[model samples]
Target chain A: MIDWSSFAYLAAAVLFILGIKGLGSAKTAGTGNVLAATGMLLAIVATLYLTRVVQLELILGGIVIGALIGSLLAKKIEMTAMPEMVALLNGFGGAASALVGISEYLSRQGETTGGMVSIAIVLSLLIGSLTFTGSLIAFGKLQGLLSSQPVTYPAQQVVNALILSAGLGLGVLLATSPFSELYLVLLLSVALLLGILAVLPIGGGDMPVVISLLNSYSGLAACATGFVLGNAGLVISGSLVGASGLILTKQMCEGMNRSLLNVLFSAFGKHVESKGADTANKTARSFTPEDAAIIFSNAETCVMVPGYGLAVAQAQHAAQELATVLEERGVKVSYAIHPVAGRMPGHMNVLLAEANVPYEQLVEMDDINPEFPETDVALVIGANDVVNPSARTDEDSPIYGMPLLDVDFARNVFVIKRSMNPGFAGVQNPLFFNENTMMIFGDAKNVLLELVTSIKES
Target chain B: MLDDPAVALTILVLALFVGVEIISKVPTLLHTPLMSGSNAISGITIVGALLAAGGEERNLAAWLGFVAIILATINVVGGFAVTHRMLAMFKGKEQR
Candidate 1:
């Protein structure tokens, strides 16, 4: 029977592998998700069968309650809030692992824990507690429950380091003497505090890195839990998550052209003020909806650039409608997507896809930059920092050295913004003051609707 | 199953390699789904949670185990469901 259960776990592991492989492409991603869910189901059933000493009623009730809440949240959550939802779920995973570690320790009150199990318990508590609190901070920032800006104070690094060291010291002490519940409690508290302080100084602009790193931490916690419980299924899945999340984090950091260490330590967007009072003095050429429509109607090639503003305004559908209308009129339209255009990595792509925009129309920054020069009109809809020319020329700009869309290279540029406000990075865009640039000030969805109507009427 | 730690560690190391290799070739557009999907996979801790919770005693261990089971289940269910919702939105040019 034990052999049979191991086989079931192994089969489930293979399914998980295939599911991940399927997620590599857009067409098969849905199937990949289903496959992974099936793998989860199999693992759960097998574990239940293997562990027969427990009450069936409790497990069923827990599953029913959890599934109800989870599915409801999944159904109700907007796509814009997907990253926050993911962060919260990652936190739950960490909390689960941490609890399992504590429960295991508590259950074995008198038995002398082996050296390996002791190490596993310490690691599980450390990583799990940190992941839980860190992910909560990430979720808070993403959902606007807390300030999105990096929260830093004097000696923040020193304070965080001291907390982390204290946690480690307690971990070592608990490992040497396994029955010290008080030491365990202290270690968990220090780890929890460390997690909060660790993420508090990370600015919202580097949220992708923070989220991914927390996701990785959750996996490491689970892997440690596996070691504590001697569970093969947990070990395999946990390590897979840990590695993939780290890789994803590295990829996002590279997309922003920043190192992981810098993203973790340096508080980005802190130097840039969010207020627009200083930039309001600069004159910006504003255009009415009709004027913007006329330019759009006459353009031979138009490139659309999207940013967080699009998400804020929920104008992705309108943007798609405008693109479709332009395409119907034989106007060539392509979308230029910045790597970090939205809150999370690939956020813009998800929004565009949700709007039913054809994937082929969305071009990456590197591929679209060279084409901008030939574009007749650069339609910047609710975007700022990624298109700002300061990244290229301004040495002291907060966004300096970050790659940007070359919208300024276009023959004519139309920027749809609510005001002359600086972007999240706190940098004023010089492209707005360029001779060819015209700002259409209004709500993104309203402006897009007007543009669509004008194009249709034309 | 608890006979040897080496076997579990071997599986851990191998899965890590496979995970990094598989995700290396994923396109930029699929990054979100991939993140969500792998996140769902990490919810496999649900199995561990169930085993912990179902054990014979109504002690502190059982209570903590119950909480673990619920949280892990949410991670699994929500992660997978949301990933599906997001993936369903990605359409090709022809499909659109």
Candidate 2:
């Protein structure tokens, strides 16, 4: 019945692939968005043309409303809220897939055979439901509505395993029978619950991995739905997402020195007994802004590492001012941007860019990691995890495998944190307790401003 | 003249996807978010695949459908695993 819809679908698929490729590089990322959006538009139009049962008015109205809501939210959201926004978008995707699956199931209720159709229905229902709930949990954690602590209980892993086993058993049962909608519903509910259970125990530090994993789940669900529909475009595109998401997840796991299973099962953010308190007491050195300025005034080269605290204090401009003042004093200043710096991905870069920091001065983690060893002064601005020495020296630390900025190797390290508290990973930073390190306790913005003034005076 | 609608639609979707992939790298700021956001777009393909396999009446089609479903399931599971891992890296000290 659909005459030319296939051609349109093919075109859309090509665009989707191109969009993803473009997304890999920073230079052409915006154009990639336009291209992807265009592909989506083409696909939506083709789908509308091909569909026989769905009403045009309803579909168009829904699109308009969704677009408006998304645009409005995007316009108003702050950078700090980006992670939650991402989580919310993921939830929306899961909900959409679930709704579509239900619609398909309802439409073909009488004509559909039980066996494979049942599997499709159950898979869609289960994955979609889990993605929905897991995304919401991630959103709540990122938005601070829920406690960021790893909510753990005795036998937590055992309970999670049981839940998964029960859910899988139910899915298998539903897949084998056509009249097992009740079992399907139960499986869906259990999967949703399992998703919540899985993510709830993970600490805030693990949210990025959770979000990425949820993203992958959402894509695979889409692919399953595509299989149910026999849509080639769905298969290809879904596979692309699933593959890329997995690779990114693997990269993230490597970034944190964690295994996929450890991430899934480990209860992160538990307060370790104060094993390093005495060590902290032995080498803790506090410094004033004036003291920091004195050290900076004489430094030949300074590397400034900014973190989420800088964003929270909105201190990018102040930091830049301090950098400029140092440069004026013949200090070769540059910013070290850890790939995973800030609350959201690239949070530091966005802030620095907003503050008019030059792109040339922003060095990535890999390039800058070794430079720290040759630097005269390493000025850390509210950064934590990226500079943690445990990532290098401590095998038992959760972040032990992730690459770190070699700030610990600098001749003099001045860490500007608000307090002596451990980072989100809930591990003590041995860097804070190092002989060359001096902790400056104050708001990042105010402290940077003071440093700028002191540098100017000197 | 009657043309095969399925074949035409397939070509169009593929083209659109290729175009998107080519253009996705335009904005440096958008690379991560777009990659993240497009995950939703990829999910939409599941609906079409499911319907196609469900509509097939043959044994071969059914087996193909089964394989597709399983592969799709693996993608979903593995993808979510990856996304969560990426997000966890940002949960460093300042965020905590």
Error of 1 at B22 (Å): 0.9
- Runs in model 2 lying further than 4 Å from the true structure: A1-3, A112-117, A276-281, A328-330, A394-401, B1-31, B43-96
Encode model 2's per-residue lDDT on B1-96: one tens digit a residue. 112445534633564454344433333333245445456466455334333334425333333333333323222222222233222332222333
lDDT string for model 1 (A129-236, tens) is 899999999999988899988898999888888888899889888877758779978988998888899998998878988888888888889889878877777787
Question: What is model 2's DockQ versus the real complex?
Answer: 0.11
Q: Give the Å shift of residue B74 in candidate 2.
A: 26
Q: What is the TM-score of chain B in candidate 1?
A: 0.89
List TM-scores for all candidates, in order.
Answer: 0.95, 0.82
Q: How many clashing pairs does model 2 include?
A: 112
Model 1, which residues run further than 4 Å from truth? A273-282, B1-8
The deviation in Å at residue A98 for candidate 1 is: 0.5
Query: Which fraction of the native contacts appears in each prediction?
Result: 0.80, 0.14
In the range A119-226, model 2's lDDT, one tens digit per residue, is: 666777778778889989999988889998889899998899899899989878866656556875687689889879988998887777777677677776766666
Pick out the ten consecutive residues of candidate 1 chain A with the lowest summed lDDT.
Answer: A272-281
